[model samples]
Target: MKQTIIITDCPEQQGWQKNRELCMDVTTYLRSDSRMKAGKSYQGVLRRDVTCDEMHYNEQMVFIETSNQKRMKRNPRIFEGEHITITRRDDGSYHPNFRPIHLGPDFNVDHYATEVANELLWGLEGLVDNA
Candidate 1:
């Protein structure tokens, strides 16, 4: 079966740019430090679309295949949409808290989309590191 994936930020909220900028800022910070061990490879994209069975906010999902493997496995959920944001920290891990923005009285599409993107990126990070 085909899977549909959506990765976007609401145009009304300026948070989209903020998220991208935060990624770039974090990349820079990680690269500049002397004591930290660089991962040697990193890639990120804005509004990147991905297909997978598992989905979560602020965490990455991955799919692996082998000749003898019979079934696919999924990981646990990480963060929620209402708890995502980018904050600089002394620690090496990248922990961005993504908060949902209300479109009106009850809509929060931007926040939802941002979390998906964050999760996808996190998944990509794991895949690349393993590769």
Candidate 2:
């Protein structure tokens, strides 16, 4: 099933870095009319773009680069006008394997993807958080 969501606010970067790569945890401070609960908003990590030379400096960097490469190989980044469509699991269940959405430029395909992913995360049965 495809759900449509309109993002009211752009993602705001949190003060802390999530890893050595300095990727920040961002929060989308907006409520939607979709599956998102009344008080809840979406949260995600901001990706860091590293140069090729930086990857050779440390094992962690190399590993991060390798992992990123592998993930991109499996599911490449969505472009400006393209949205990632995740197929529902068999038996008509929602699986929460969400992907990262590009947040640059106008919030069209990327923003919608992020909002739908948040909806899937917070709305799906047995996955909703009570806290």
Candidate 3:
């Protein structure tokens, strides 16, 4: 099954920075997966770019270079390789929610992904509070 995890940072101070860090953590998770590897390292355009018309003004786009482009283009649902977005709330408080996108019947994947995502958020709470 395919799944997408969207981790939003709270609206507190330095929320954008924290959100970026959490996104990095997600990337770390993807990197550790045996089925996946970091795609080509390309300089991503900011949301201000013309191609980013679909994204909100606050959204930052990061391109993921993947191995199996054909599979991704075909199935699209598999979380095996995808570029994810880490969104920040307009209120400036990090959104503590971790949204699961295109989840499948595998309870283990849902459970484990949510578990790790929440743990990452919890770890950020202390850091965000301190900052």
lDDT on C-alpha atoms for all candidate structures? 0.44, 0.40, 0.41
Candidate 1 lDDT by residue in tens digits, 1-131: 33544445664353433323233212122223344345743222223334455564352322222133345323223333344433334443445554655567775778667766877576556645856
Compute the lDDT for candidate 3: 0.41
At residue 10, candidate 2 shows an lDDT of 46
True-structure lDDT of candidate 1:
0.44
Q: Would you list the clashing residue pairs of candidate 2?
A: none
Poorest stretch of ten by lDDT in candidate 3: 74-83
Model 3, 80-105: lDDT tens digits are: 11222233455445433344656567
Cα deviation of 50, candidate 1, in Å: 57
Residue 9, candidate 1: C-alpha displacement in angstroms = 54
Better of 2 and 3 by lDDT: 3
Q: Residue 110 of model 1: what lDDT?
A: 80
